[model samples]
Target: MTSIDAARGMYFEDFAIGQELRTPERTITSTDIVNFACLSGDFNEIHANHEYCKRTPFGEPIAHGPLVYSIMGGLQYASGINDGTLLALLQIDAWRMLAPVRHGDTLHMRSTVVGKKETSRPDRGVVTFARRCLKQDGSVVQEMRATLMYRRRPPA
Candidate 1:
């Protein structure tokens, strides 16, 4: 189903392996970096100092990895596929930063269900999703696998 029709959250039983959901796009900005720097207390030159960044391979100030990762988390929620059905994030695995995210970069998240299993609790289950953060050009800038807890379908 399209995002418009699937705005409601999905239950554990609703997910199928290889099923993909794309989130609305977002643009990265300089103010985002500044705000993140202040909020995270991470004043790294590569993230907040243009002059310092000019000497680096990226040649420009880049957003913090964690900041972009955090944005992906928000995108996941905004996608609405995990809305109220999601219970908790169990784990993040093999998270990798493959490219620098700079100001004006439009990005979106693609989440695919990769695995699922019933838990001891009949009311909930575990789901593993492969998440990819892609730039407007279709380049994957970051990727990770996350395990989450989700409720099962309720009794009819």
Candidate 2:
């Protein structure tokens, strides 16, 4: 492999339609929720107040939707699918939170390469990935389609 290839992960050309990538699981903790709450300044009762949640269907504090999404992003990055080959996140479409994420719920993501488009530029392309976040019980907690720009394989 060339130095350029060694420096990068998967490139735009490396992805094919229907190709899937599964990330390692991550367990959400109360501390994660608290830290996310502090960072986002979202002190909602459903996410931060146990007593308030006790009156609700969940019966306890739950994680923020954004926090789950953020963790999914981290998981994806950790998977090294894009690594240094990623250029930019162009768009996120059809983002849906299907279920609540509670503390101690382990989650992972399955990302499928759904679409690809070659740009006019020779060095880059666009790819759309359908990302799904599932909990330990196989329940889908969230789903989204992320369109991202990526570098092409460099010349030898």
Candidate 3:
């Protein structure tokens, strides 16, 4: 485990390759679907109507893929990455949806550090991670890599 600060004081040196950090579990509900629909203007029938979705291969109203991505991104912020020494998100790589996320399912997310390197800038560093989003059954719904820049510990 990477020795991250307990109360939002993370620095570049605290992260390690292959460290997995899990976010708090979240439940997806019908209201969440509606609210996301309103916010995103994605009125696609499969995400809105159970009846319509039942006719499809999925057999139930599945959450929107983008909504799932948004939830995964939100989970990162909720886990204190931004609250800690976050400076900026440098890039997202290979984001892909693997399975349908359905309403009423419990989801959990984790980010595993893939690599880290010091930047040319002495006061910052770059970290790369692959985040996994999984259902309560532990099936992966989404996976992606994010490149982040964080403030390094001050030179003593």
Cα lDDT listed for each candidate: 0.93, 0.93, 0.86
Candidate 1's residue-wise lDDT over 1-156, tens digit each? Answer: 643433389999899999998999999999999999999999989998889999999899999999999999988888887887899999999999999899999989998999999999999999998999999999999999999999898786
lDDT (10s digit) by residue, model 2, range 1-156? 644346546899899999999999999999999999999999998988989999999999999999999999899888888789889999999999999999889999999999999999999999999999999999999999999999999786
Query: Between prediction 1 and prediction 2, which has the larger TM-score?
Result: 2
Stretches off by above 4 angstroms in model 2 are 1-5
Q: Residue 1 of model 1: what lDDT? A: 62
Local lDDT at 137 for model 2: 99
The 10 consecutive residues of candidate 1 with the worst lDDT sum are 1-10
TM-score of 1: 0.93
Best by TM-score: 2
Question: Which of the two candidates, 1 or 3, achieves a greater lDDT against the reference?
Answer: 1
Model 2 residue pairs with clashes? none
Q: lDDT tens string, model 3, 82-126?
A: 676889989988999999888788988989999999999999999
Candidate 3 least-lDDT 10 residues: 1-10
